[model samples]
Target: MSMTANTAMAASTPRRGSSIAWSDVLLNIYILIFFLYLFVPLLIMIGAAFNVNSTPSITDWQGFTLDWFTGEVDEETGRVIAKGLPQEDRFLQGLWHSVIIALGVVAIAIPLGLSGALVLTRLQSGSTTFLYTLLISPILTPGIVLGVTTMIFWRDIFSVEAGLFTTMIAHSTFIASYCMLMFMARLQRQDRGLEEAALDLGASNVMVFRRITLPFLRPTILTAAVIGFLQSMENYNTTFFAIGGSWTLVTEIGSRMRFGLTPVINAIGVIFIVITVVAAVAWVFFRKREKG
Candidate 1:
């Protein structure tokens, strides 16, 4: 009986191993498929940027060239044969506009968000729930409605035309909620004892906040600023209606898509990808170095 049981157990071991191996193989295939789905289009876009084709295409590769970055040069006359990213004045302007709007959104959103977070977190009131709901309502509101309402509000109330300012305002409306959430999360983790101790030691409320509260919230503020900037930069629907005659880099890209796509757009994507990768790498290294 012992001999028979030993043989049976040994036989079952191989079957278990085989099942485990098959599951691992299936998992690996799934991961491969997922990664391929995620990155294949990005790889195609990057490839298209180098292709000499006028239109953005990976399959119809004319030849590898840097004409997208630097305009096709007329060798004889030394003049531009075709417009490139550098020569695309409107796109460049739009990029500049995006940067400006992002900065403005960050500036506006961070302060408003901080204020809201402070009110909700510090004030012990029954109305806090209502106030919290009201403050966060903008985030739930549709971008189109926000854009249209913002445009109309400015035009009707202050006679301010929809432009970069309106676009910035529209972005800030919802972005502020994002910032507030970040601030609140940071605030929740804060040690209230320090503030209480400082106050007990005869420190003014302003001084306690400036020294303790502000220092604790610094990292969250930086994070919020970055998030706000990114949100403002990528915003489309709200910007489209609020911007009136103006345009940002994203909106300009959308407009171009309607007309026709170009390798310049791919070049832009590649540049952003490179920047994002570099930033991520730098952040990792910085964190490791700090830890070390």
Candidate 2:
């Protein structure tokens, strides 16, 4: 009777492997589908960069060539030559403008964010919530509205026109909020004992800030810079409304998409992909080495 009961319990219980395997299989399938969805279009875009097609298409392979990326017209032979700078003058100039704007955004956002974070974290009053909300309101505002408002304010009040400066300002308005959040997160995790010990040692406020607080915030600063730069570089709506005559790389790409579509665009995409991949690889290696 005991043996029969044990056998009945075993028959009723499900196998562990069989139950877990279904969930594992489903998770793997989901991950595969997600990755494919993300990378399939990028692969197509990269392939088109290599193809010698006028239009950006991977369906019709037109052989491999890098002319679209760095092609130049030969003076004597009048043939397109490779190894020169990209021939899209507007795009190149726009890229430079984008770089300058990104730098400005980082410059403006990081300090402002640090200040706001410090204030919010240190405040012990109810007004802190109001101030925090005010500081972060720009982030919740629509990009279009931010851009338009910035353009109008600068033009009407400061006698400044819509250009790179206005665009940078507009970008910083929202980007500072992101930087503040990062700094706040980092600050929350920090050991207050270190700061208190420094204060007990009779260190001046500025010295304490420079030596302790700044050092503690170094990693956050780098992260904020990277995020701010990327945010400024890729911004469109705010930039479009704020920039009257100037353009950034992303804005130039939009204009090109509207007027002319070419493999050149694909080439740009390839460059961006290469940079992103290299950065990701480097970050992974850095983490592995740090762990080691």
Candidate 3:
């Protein structure tokens, strides 16, 4: 019996397959290299922020210093020689302009998006595709085209110069499309019967919208605001052309990259990285806690 069992076990374990595919191994290596390529620049940039050198480079590393972020500190006098003042910084000035534009985008985009979504969703005709395409054409158009067209149109027609206002408008033209798409998605999931019942019960159209539609869309409104704000903040080409001589933080960064590169720019990048990581972590934590 022992001999028979041993023979059976040996027979069951006798399988020998071909070697692992070189293609799969090469694909995994390629994936690793691809990730490294993407991350290496960010790592180098982050590393330079901690170096004391004025130039943004990791190869010529100086001792660690925080002067770029917190201004210069007097070593002997103990009083800060350069108190980390954002107000005195050109980058900070551009950041303030970015914030102003972002706020303006949220204000304009939310309303336009809401209106567009309303029209698209409520339309009873089958020929609504043309209108939808027309409305969404701005999103498909290149940002540079939008910026140049807006700048020229305003200059020729409205006598408005290309500046912060024009940048805000250029951003809104596409951003509103994003908001409208989000709103349309939410509206599709909505039970229209509730709105109709409210209207039938003598509620004014505005009242029904205010009480029913707005409440249901509150979550979407917040999401659209966040998306629109981020889009506005990160915009470059549109803002560059439509902003005339003015600058936002992103455009300022571009100009610095073109004219003079410095560790201060890396410092700015570090701040952005920290803020993004913190926000993502906090969002996850809050969501988990809420679910629990």
Q: What C-alpha lDDT values do all the predictions have?
A: 0.93, 0.91, 0.89
Cα shift from native, residue 90, model 2 (Å): 0.9
| Candidate whose lDDT is highest | 1
lDDT of 1: 0.93
- Using all chains and alpha carbons, the TM-scores for the candidates as numbered come to 0.87, 0.87, 0.84
Question: Candidate 1: which stretches are off by over 4 Å?
Answer: 1-21, 75-78, 283-292
Q: In candidate 3, what are the lDDT values of residues 1-292, reduced to their tens digit?
A: 9899999877865453334356658889999999999989999999998888778788998788887787886678877664343423678889999999999999999999999999999998986898899889989999999999999999999999999999999999999999999999999999999989998999999999899999999999998999899999999988989999999999998998998887778888998888888978987997899788
Model 3 ranges off by over 4 Å: 1-27, 73-88, 282-292
* Candidate 3 positional error at 88, Å: 5.4
Error of 1 at 211 (Å): 1.1
Which candidate order results from sorting by TM-score in descending order?
1, 2, 3
Q: For model 1, name the residue pairs that clash.
A: none
For every model shown, the clashing-pair count is 0, 0, 0
